[model samples]
Target: MASETIVPPTVGDQADCNEVNTCHVDEFLYDVEEVEKLAKKGKLKRQYCLDCNSRNITAYYFSNAGTIIGVEMNKECCEVQEKIINQYSMNQNRIKVIHSDVMDRSDIVASSNIIVANVLDFFVDIEKHKKIWYFFKQHIKKGSYLICNRSITDTLESIGLSEELIDWLSICKPCRQENEIFFDLEDFMDMHLYKVN
Candidate 1:
């Protein structure tokens, strides 16, 4: 008799649309005008946002039927996501929001062009930081960009985490001038961008 075969699900297969449809989450993040704008610009593709920024314009491109792979979206970050989505109503099909825990999900690869990890410091322990870095390294295509943010208090709270973890998140504190609201030197918030090569 032949043995039964068991196969693990692929990244595409593991994502269950029935559990949380994109539209439900979309409604929470976007409005009519914003959606229309995105459609008009033909910028709707794959875009990610950690902390909202005017420079995060890749979202406009991805939202309009462009191919956007991964987005590090949290329930609290939905507002910014909606604002970007609302810019393009016709291209909503280009977007997919994965509601999984960013730190723990192994399915996410480095194939994404834009990786945004906003306020992620709040959720992870120090030991897991290297895994996070390696995870990003694995999935991002060469020359792809990674965006990350961390709050000071968020970092302090992360002290309970491992030393390696703190080093990973604290590598680059974004200049306050670049990000007025989210990047404050004294406040313990930092944003970084990395190009995968």
Candidate 2:
């Protein structure tokens, strides 16, 4: 039997969509050393995230995804992944890029071992947020993880969604498993890691 060759993800020409998924790695700063320090202590596995504008985080993840494959979803016209696909031609197969909304894709969520979303609050409304939570509960497999910028507890409390949020997080128990490493980026934002129960 022959080993299959990995190909980079397919990307669109632009990233503009009715809604743009941007993980503002800069807006909410974090300490890189701290995240890496944590990541070194735990298991690092296949991961997924979306709306990789500017190709900054995508490139960063691209480097890491070499050993552990990841799936990145962006708008149909996303160029960040396209640029990365062109620059690191060899890594194209490591990270699969899909053009779709994070809320709309439960399949990807089911496959990923870890999912990270920065500035998730900025992307959708309260209703959409609920739907997102539903996706997390319904699709994210047990033992998988979720990393995000805002506190799910706080967000739920502020939005009067504590009950629902609690139910979901109870299964996706709040956890701190791995260190998140970002190139030149600090883990300034109080990002939380949750493990699905």
Score every model by TM-score. Answer: 0.39, 0.53
User: Model 2 Cα RMSD, Å?
Assistant: 18.5
Write down the TM-score for model 1. 0.39
lDDT for each residue of candidate 1 in 4-120, tens digit (9 for 90 to 100): 343434469655433122222154556877766664676442243437423334423413324554445466565466556675452456665555566455455444556666554
Q: Model 2 segments beyond 4 Å from truth?
A: 1-77, 170-189
Against the correct fold, how does model 2 do in TM-score? Answer: 0.53
Indicate the worst ten consecutive residues by lDDT in candidate 1.
16-25
Question: In model 1, where do residues sit more than 4 Å from their true spots?
Answer: 1-65, 69-90, 103-108, 150-191
lDDT of 2: 0.58
lDDT of each: 0.50, 0.58
How would you encode candidate 2's per-residue C-alpha lDDT over 76-172 as one tens digit per residue? 4456766656654545556556767776677777887787765556767888877777777888887877776777788777667788657555423
Who wins the TM-score comparison? 2
